[model samples]
Target chain A: MSDKPIALDAMGGDHAPHEVVAGAVHAVRERGLSVVLVGPPRVLYEALEDHRATKEVPIVRADEALAMDEGALASLRRPRSSIAIACHLVRQGNASAAVSAGSTAGIVATGRLRLKGLPGVLRPAIAVALPTLPKPTLLLDAGANADAKPEMLVQFAHLGAAYAETAFSIGKPRVGLLTIGGEAEKGNKLTRRAHELLTASPALHFVGNVEGHDLLTGLADVIVTDGFTGNVALKTMEGAVQYAFTELRNTVNAHRAARLGALMQRGALRDLQRRLDSEAHGGAVLLGLTGTVVIAHGSSRAAGISAACQLAADLEKGGVVTRIGERVASTHRTHRLW
Target chain B: MSDKPIALDAMGGDHAPHEVVAGAVHAVRERGLSVVLVGPPRVLYEALEDHRATKEVPIVRADEALAMDEGALASLRRPRSSIAIACHLVRQGNASAAVSAGSTAGIVATGRLRLKGLPGVLRPAIAVALPTLPKPTLLLDAGANADAKPEMLVQFAHLGAAYAETAFSIGKPRVGLLTIGGEAEKGNKLTRRAHELLTASPALHFVGNVEGHDLLTGLADVIVTDGFTGNVALKTMEGAVQYAFTELRNTVNAHRAARLGALMQRGALRDLQRRLDSEAHGGAVLLGLTGTVVIAHGSSRAAGISAACQLAADLEKGGVVTRIGERVASTHRTHRLW
Candidate 1:
């Protein structure tokens, strides 16, 4: 088992300390991973006691708690909040990584503000593993910064490439720029400039422009875009998935034959469901930070939280942060971006 | 049955005269709709003969043909092309409407240049019916113009609202400006300004900003957006649907039980598939034009073309163009953008 510990924000997410504590217990007992729960001691103790895991899990008392509604300013105002404290633990070497199922914006702001970014990094990007055909494709800038320069997108590509290589163990991951069309000159000014920069960059395996359809076909291992388009694309895909599954469920329940078929196909359906489940892969990771930070979904349950912890541990063990810093530094040193 | 005739661009679309001729025949025989094939008479005659229905479908002689590869400039240069000829027929009272499975940009440009816009309209908007839950949702400015000012978006909303009310029969169709979030101040500069303009306009049923997720949920009856974002969102949704269905097919075929279930649930599955199929909706209509012009998919088959013809007939019979003209004229008379 790994000796490295993860600092988990127990007061965050929809289910709060109960599900968070239960998830931590499962990670400790089943995954054999250590976790430091950072939240109000009283509430966390009660939650841990409910799972009969008081002695098993350790609580790092953080009196201040940031609500999910809090914005980026909350990170500055409440420096010792649960999520901030979690990041602080990682910064102070008390924890190897930080796991939080909080507001994406809040987590990103806190992570950047608290842990700070690595040397030579322009900006941190949020990379999400989309379960596509054959393999899971990594999409970056899921919702980090809304406005991005062409140079920032190129940096995002490098960050995504390093992530794919480390997290998925893919060799020479192909990076593709998300655009309206596959044609070289088919997007807005940003995409056109990014395409030119990406193609010219020797550090990345830049495959040309890829349309939205290519997101789930494993056309490229690492897909990079500005946060605005990337976030919209990701959310649109999620919405479509939910709508489809809802329609599928209704169709399956429409008649006796469908019901019987649904029953017979339960195993395969479960497999498909599991494959598409965002929670299974954990939430998106904020890359370019000094330490690994995994941000699970706000609505995550125990299983999702456990999966997030496992992902955070795996990322730490995989040397993701160090690899990203090295890649950025090497690229900056060799090829300067004007 | 309706006595009005539709001018069909026979030489357009991927399959061209073959599918176009077949779709015309199907419309006459199956849907009881009248259509005049606008293309080279000899080629259309040969195609009609192959379908064994030369006498069933009438052919209109047009010497020029618009290649699918042609861009917007081709609309001005190739004045007598098939699509232009079709729109000309509509303008001359020879046909009630025009339907073409040709180049979308060419069709939009030709419709505006040839048929012209309704009085008081800024620019025509392409409105596509997205297959959302419960009912279909209408999205406008799919690709009419790449860049749009805030005033243009407000006009597009009116255009979409007119379409939803006339075509979908939705009363007071709630209009939404498609953006990154539901907040009034959550999008880019254009969207922010568009939101304010839409809310202030009494001509529309402005419901604030709706995110991409709302596209599939029928949150708003008429979704308005700038042409670039709308086109991107539409294509993204189409690509996502294709990816999802592909993934589902693989999952269904992976196991024996799932295969058995697939057989039993085939009917419901088919229904769901048809609902999600873009072709089933009879392509996107370029609204705010003087005459009804339906731009079918470039890769449309016989059924899709026939559906487009039927849609054109329906819109024409419903007096869509007249209503749109009145709406725009009144809105412009009261509150002029210029």
Candidate 2:
């Protein structure tokens, strides 16, 4: 990771170039990291000028932008979209990584088309860090491959394990299969087959099947599942957290004594919220690709964008892409499903 | 539904023959619901005597008992298991409904084997009422069928709709297919086909696809999915709620002001907990069967067991079984997959 600037899609996310430019300014001034904003020069230059960071961060021109509501087809519809240009910079070795808060489908499609998957990698997986006690757990195939084969699930385990090792610096990360039951003989055909394959693989520290309740328990360092299940579980957790806080707020506001108590412990509650915040963790990372890519939340502000930039830089510095490539190649050869 | 007693599996659950017996006593003595305890005569008699309701609740002899750890196979291995006897009572019209705080797999297997599926049900599904705002959302195939065909998903929709109609008194409940994306074109093969079938049916109030975030948002009255995804999503929500409360407790206890506020708002917090507690909702109902059966949590206490009994009686009294039978038969005939 030669001091190459991280390429960011300034036109992506709900807040657009303003928040994205502010984040780049923060990364350069506070974090001392090089960053290149990819979007229309006129709009980005004004955004950077608003933060007085015109001289600090560089700009790359991208004519088209992918809309938040757009899907994978938008990647082809807009060839030089902001996210596409960001990936182009990374693929061309002009940038260390690509960070975007664009539509997940568009980013994933553009990533696959531009950056391409690593050698022997079946498909790219979206790895999310679950805020858990002791250490955060990694869940893979968050939404990248909705319909996956048993072989793909095994590949996701390898991808997730390598990610946990790189991001969290864990040794021999324990991987678990996410299914309905905690038994080898349980689950649908795909998981049951994947469970057997995972157990047989000497390279993986495969803990047996873990249920949905084990997601936040830190029972496994990395839990692998199909993209559909992973996406649903991850979103379900987000919804639950949001609902709990909403109910808590209503309860606190209903009584004056409770309100005073909440006000007094507001700092502690804020700390707890920060600890469980997904956006604070830099969103999900797209792994098994040639270059590192971080997909921040669509509603991210400057702080979240900066966090995503830091994560992208960290992964590039840690050589996560190379790690995943080696692990996939070695494990795929030995544990051939065919 | 007649004046027949609700069959209670006294040998099931963690605190079996004691908590189950106590729960039966409460139903008979307080709720004025007729109850029959099914288990070993000696053990049940002792439990009833402890509750001082030996005459209030009748005892039905069942020598064999299904262990809490046993899965579907136990239904066959122990043909005369307490759960089996409870189902027998229902089939013989001696009991209006069967209620058990036992292993979900064992209850589902025994229910299907003894009570049997109604006219056109592909398989029995576990319908759990999610503690959502305004009204509880019904999610089905909680863990019954790990693998389900597209046709089965449609059947689940009908079953869930019927349940919402009977339990919540909702007329023409909206049905949503649980999938990765909100668009009808977004999911895998099974959901894609199910969406088409759901849209084509005149009997269904199909509102299109729903993501995991919609589970607690009350966007749909009945959300249907394959057993594997539903089980995972339901458990994940439970885990998230538990984790949030645990973190909140630690945060509140760490500070004096927070502790005071928590003490002041204790009543409201307890109300919120009761609102979200799955056991309070009488656990998951095994639907799409000939008889009304409620499977309480395996770790249920006396209160939870009593709640399960009340739920079973309510469903029996509401004629939910006949309602589901009519819905399934009509919809299955019109939307024949074959």
Candidate 3:
């Protein structure tokens, strides 16, 4: 059991204090998880009072909060921001993990500066679980280091593999290098060199290369790429899914028979949507940090926030941070790249 | 008017020779387009015979063929390969364009080497039409230059704009920089720098930065990015769509009601698939080259090949290569980055 509560940034995300407070209440009441809301006292208190859960969750007062539109520089400028304060709580061992739905840039930048990286972590990465058959595939450096060296990619592979092993209980997770082609030689200069390093590393169960199409096929348990490519790929998948659903809805509406058919299968269709929802997976986990950190979707509502808190608590309980530390340390010892 | 036939690579793709021959036959008989098949005479002649159109479609003898598994270097090694021969026909003024359902790397490399880049073009890029509403959004650097200079991105904008204007009849195509965030400063080093250059260029109606989610939303008429990210985004979209459909199929089959509904709406669902098919857009076009080139999907069947040939002929007639030449030259003169 986690002794420390999850430090939640109440003022982060588009929904802010209201949804965040509701989510905190749900986590405490429904999920039985300890959570500490971090934001301006009066605003958060009023929001929590709306749900009549002021007694259930504790408050860590922080006057300043990073705006949703603010970028990474805001992390440095607004040191007392809600996200920063949440990170501060985790750093001080008052909390087990930091959960935020603010600007990804701000969360990543603040987490790096506040919680700091693990012993051998070059850069903290964002690891996301992609919904796939059998189990989810973990993709990393989802947006942490936009520009990455070949060595950083090798570290990402380890980070992703360790997380998959710890989080999904998969032994020897097959690591893959994401690039343009399935062939080893096909990619940009960065990926080409990274492929060579990944292939040479004995620590990983290296699966040569996986194309973008392979991301959802469960071809590899852990797929590693630079933050830029990873971010684009993630967003592209989001957009594609949204577009397809829109098209499907339009198709169902175009004809009388289709409409009747869709009505009959409505429950099943909704279930499929729920299974593919990012919020259900607890958003994206920021790996390689000194403490457990979960960055929920910026547009997350009450349910998403609650799911993120649950994930943060689960990751803390699973010892993902320590597992990552051990894996990185062992790999570094064998490879001597660091 | 296109003066010569489109040079088709017969010994390319998974269903090579047979499907390629059938497509060529379809182009001549159905689409009213002229096409010349390039491959081994004995094999191609026999393939043409199977279609019973040996005399209808002419054959260009090329003893060698690049295997589907071959990469860019294969373009250099096998000068007589079907794809290489197709490019040679375009270079020699015997064909108006080159059409191939071959290895993209082999096609792009051979196209660059044989057909060559235009005078002001920095690097030739592959442009694909995304299946969106109103009109398809054109995404470039689809797989051409894995690595790109900021200046090269400016050239891509011009290239894409010209193609959109000529191909889609858009007088001023709005160009968007594909990156992680919608803000100008939100991408990696390459995209950030490219954003600055794209914003400064007067030749483009640059609408500023767009995210992966915007790819299908039709926010911008032309979206430009480095080839690595573009290729990944494209494939990711493809994978996501395929996965969604697969899940929908499972959802439909899960319940008797859903199955009955799906049966009733089968026609509408099939129509939806056709609307989103890559083959319907005539595959992807290689721009900024001296000669027009079309690279069909590697697994293209007769219909895909025919669509690619028709697209190749249309692009040749539209003078996309010349339009791109003028656009790049004008931008280079104004910007002076090259």
Candidate 4:
């Protein structure tokens, strides 16, 4: 529908070019989205041929690929890495957005090194959509920067707010600082200082401190935390969900009545499964970058990759990068941190 | 059938005398556990009279009550407080254990001040039973000490291991240090150092660092962390469970087929609910105490309180206090931290 094409890091993720190329084909065929697959040309063409989609999905030659085991420094050195080349496409106006399912550190590092950070932005933050009640809650700094200053947390809030508004169409999203308790001074020194900083930020709809319990209750549209806590909470919730479903499956098979019940409830159960599936929400977005960059799960399949491409296209159409830049610029103009 | 009686802090929790007294009656009548209700006799008797259970439940006279608003100092000043009196009963060998659904801080303070910590124990840590698969996982230092040293974390591992062995009947429980990641060097400085200390400890089954995702997977029988992270993780998991159920309810009610499906899956749903219910496992136990003290939810109802009383009695029968003392005494003989 739109002329803007997405740069797909075909060499990234668990399935590499095979699933990535299939996902690109699906996006173009089913979702009517333009995508330029970036990876080793021969490998990507073969993968596309396997899907009988080589003619449909175009491939951009990228000689190098950043392995999943590599660290952030690898992204800096390997400028020709698949994710880096994808970002370069976005920066060079050949593509509107870049999507990768490689190592998070690599994506964040390459996004910053290649596309560069937005004007006035202190640091880039990773925002993941949590499937919370009423809607998906946006949690920022999921695991980008572990040791962030209080000022950096404030910027994360602004960045999360912009993403929530643009991606979810949530207007003036209520932001809450993640802490141990709901009280103003309950958490460690970092949270205490962040609470004050967030409350003072006029750009954010600061709702005060929210405990871990508030993350999924729709207590706030945007939940901001230092990467340390946010990463733990996010992973904990994901693990719990997995455990619950596993238990639910076991419970369903425990008795004949339960088995029958499961059969009848299959539709509802599938809907619930879809809602809880992390792949359905695409993946984490590296915010504050000059270009839109989405980092999918490393173990992501074709569905997840396609979802990530859709997410990247949506973010590009929504002008998330420009909005984040504007918000950072305004915040810095008022209260400069860097 | 147990001869040992538990002293219930009647003037505690959100519902106070009503729920506590009702729970006491239920424990005695249903579970056959002897209980001595500790509170202001006049008010407690009136509450009992209202339930027509005065003759069934015996009340122990305690003139003062600790307000939920009060902190640690309240335990020292109000020596005659209900929770303090409950702990005193255990100290005097009149009651085998003490159970309170009051302020955690108040209970911890009263237990430590009135009954004192186990010999050579640096601090008492709270251990909560996580309803994980196969077997329940034990998470220690749920909120007792916010900022724990590496030594304290090692101590918590021992305490949790002991509780898991005695209470859960698990032998040589696999102890995992709860950190941001499963890798040994993946967490904050404290975790990295604690990993070394825990692995070096001869008393525990140190299985290395376990991430938040491992909590519900039963990766380790005993999971140890500082109170701050443990409390947050526990609450976060609880919140996610609540949110998941709420969303499931909404999804079921959305259409006729889904509603019919819900009716069919009602049995399995009830089973899942019972398995996920934290109250069924009773309250969190404050480990490393000279006396067995259990802290129930502040808003616990009759069944929850009854479960706490049952848990306290079970721990007492299993010699939780003696075992904790033995662990602390042994740890001291080797490391000499105290």
Docking class of 2: medium
TM-score (all chains, Cα) for each model = 0.91, 0.96, 0.95, 0.90
How do the residues A200-243 of candidate 1 rate in per-residue lDDT, one tens digit apiece?
A: 88888988988777787789999998776777777777777667
Compute the lDDT of residue B35 as modeled in candidate 1: 91
Model 2 local distance difference test score = 0.87
Best by TM-score: 2
lDDT of 1 by residue, B1-338 (tens): 23769999998889998898999999999998889999999999988888888888888888998888887788899988999999999888889999998888788888988897777788888989887655578888887776678988888877877777777788898888887766676667778888888888887788888887888888898888867667667766766766666666666665554445556355766677666775423559988877889988888889898989888888888888878878777777767553
DockQ, candidate 3, vs. native dimer: 0.81
Query: What are the per-residue Cα lDDT tens digits for candidate 2 across A119-151?
Result: 999899999988886778988889898889998
Residue A69 lDDT (model 1): 80
Error of 3 at B23 (Å): 1.6
DockQ of 2: 0.75
Q: Could you tell me how far off, in angstroms, the CA of residue B141 lies in candidate 1 after the best superposition?
A: 2.7
Against the true two-chain complex, what DockQ does each candidate achieve? 0.50, 0.75, 0.81, 0.57
Model 3 scores a C-alpha lDDT of: 0.86
Write out the backbone clash pairs for model 3.
Answer: none
Question: Residue A287 CA error for candidate 3 (Å)?
Answer: 1.8
lDDT (Cα, tens digit) per residue for candidate 2, span B16-61: 8788888888888788889999998988888888877888888999
Candidate 2, A126: how far from true, in Å? 0.4
